[model samples]
Target: MALARGFADPVHDAQAVFRTVMDALARPGLVRRLACGLAPPAPLTPELAALALTLADADTPIWLDPSLAGCAAVSAFLRFHAGAPIVANPAEAAFALIADPGACPPFAAFAQGTPAYPDTSATLILALARLSEGRGLGFAGPGIRGRAQLDAAPLPPDWPERLQANHAAFPRGVDLVLTAPGRVAGLPRSAQALVPEEA
Candidate 1:
């Protein structure tokens, strides 16, 4: 049902979502779950859809990959809820939400900001099965000092390679927000990831 019985639920949910987002960004390497339940359609999972609702608006430009089966459904929902502009290509997007990362465009194809204002790069929000945990690639950098693992299953073979290239761009590469069933993690501009050595 609708959450707004009064001022309390909406206020609380908003605070919770905001807190989750803040935690994701603040920690940088860990995934924090958002409270999700707003179903849009197939392929565009509830958690991802909730994020779109929480973070987007008319000012944001979003790009949707063709892999998401509910493009029309998601587009209509976004138009109704966020009023955000939906672009046809990834390069044109400020936020490109991808349900299937394997088919996603190469990192070089997206906008890597010019030297003057390298921070103008795009943010890619990818829908994942889990954030990251032990036995996976270890990450370290700005927010992380030592190392930590995540349960990032079923990504493209070259995802880490792509990220490495993106990282090399210094201040110009795309940032990432990986969301799963209820959790998400934000990988910002300053972090670096180290893949585990295979024994």
Candidate 2:
């Protein structure tokens, strides 16, 4: 099978994507656009593919959700572009790409860093259909002033509950980076996802 093309300018594109990702993580619910123009394999959206290319490296172990894992093209793309090793064990993954959020396990299922080394925990990159503003989960935490709203749908009904658990775990929990067609958002473990009643 022919491999797809990655970033047009590898260095600058990766740096651009990395900066956008960091900005999103710094301000929960904030969305940033990416224009790397990468055409990775199926089930790998440009946004997620950009993330993989920007963040994953030979030293980072990646875990793909069932859908992404079963797609040979997707694996090949990651290997060729990201140069990251694919790991079957979620607990061992430095980054976990989730193409099917509904079937994704709870946050606790992945690696939670030790209290002494919180930064070692896994970061989850979720591929969503889209992200909308002003009407989803309420967010508040370090980056947020008072509260912020984000709507990334097609997620499991218990997403808020799961997020609450993730937030409560604090420095030890996995952080989330959500991706749509050309945009991305972050939900760091420090950010709180308020349930409906609390919103």
Candidate 3:
């Protein structure tokens, strides 16, 4: 079996990916391309790989969905490159990687930090097929001036409702990183996902 490839230039590559993640989070609903070269195991894209490299570290515990968890190559790559420990329990994880957001566990299943320490909440990294092109949902909140439209298809049908409930928790909700082939988007706890009104 071949070992998965990590960043060609660790420091520089991680910094670049981190910048893109920060921009996406600061400008919720915006789609950004991650320009990195990584060949992680199956179901892991360049964007997702960059995200895992940028976010996970020695102190952070990560949980992978069944498929990814079963892949020894993926586990070894993450462990060696990011120095992140893999945990079995989702609630104990600071980060959770889900290959199929449509089949992901409910929002409440992951850690939702307490009001006093909301920063401890889990961050979910989701691998999506492709972001919706035409219609999806409207986003409103902090980063968004008025509103931003996002086409997030293949997500569970009740995602909007689930997100609404999650947002109601204020500072105590999980954050999401949605990644495609080379593109990524952030959906912070503060962002509201709403169904677009009929035209």
Candidate 4:
């Protein structure tokens, strides 16, 4: 099978994507558009491919969830374009691509970094079925002014509880970037999920 092409302008496109990623993280629970110019293989979405191209490198090891790992084309595409090492161990990865959000592992399953070097934690890039509409979850913390809401699904039903614990871990936790088609959103470790009664 023929592989899809990467960004038309690597320098500019990557910069745009980087900004989008940053903005999403900066404004937790806010959605942003990723005008990624790639059409990667099945299971590997444009947003995920764009992220892999923009963030992954030779030094960064990436872990793909079973859904994505089983796709040979997705592996080949990332290997060819990102030139990043694919690791079998999630704890050893600097980044992880999750194509099946419902089946994705808990935050504790991946690297949660150390108190001294919290930046070493793994970042999960989750592909969601609908980021624009779902059962809304409220968030509050650092990046958010008061509180913010997001509706990305089908995430694990325990996500709110999981995220709360992830936040309580403070400087040692995993961050999440959610994507759907051309849309992207962030749920950084600093963002704390609110219970329904509070939302």
* Top candidate (lDDT): 4
Error of 4 at 165 (Å): 0.7
Q: lDDT tens digits, residues 1-199, model 2?
A: 9999989999999999999999999999988886779878888888889999999999999999999999999999999988999999999999999988878788887999988999899999998887876888899999998999998977998898999998898878999999888888999999998886744
Model 4 TM-score? 0.95
Which lDDT tens digits does candidate 1 get at residues 12-100? Answer: 66567767876786677786767665666667777666667667778877888887634576777666665689888677777788898
Choose 3 or 4, whichever is better by lDDT.
Answer: 4
Q: Which rank order by lDDT, best down to worst?
A: 4, 2, 3, 1
Question: Candidate 3 has which clashing residue pairs, if any?
Answer: none
TM-score, candidate 3, is 0.94
Q: Give per-candidate clash totals.
A: 5, 0, 0, 0
TM-score of 2: 0.97
Q: Residue by residue across 58-169, what tens digits does model 3's lDDT show?
A: 9999999887888888888889888999999999999999987888888888999999999999999988887643356888899987878778756887888888888888
lDDT per residue for candidate 4 within 1-94, as digits (tens), equals 8887988999999999999999998988889988897889988989999999999999999999998999989998999899999999999999
| Overall lDDT per candidate, in order of appearance | 0.72, 0.90, 0.85, 0.91
Model 1 deviation from native, Cα RMSD in Å: 3.6
lDDT of 2: 0.90
TM-score of each: 0.86, 0.97, 0.94, 0.95
Model 1 TM-score, 2 decimals: 0.86
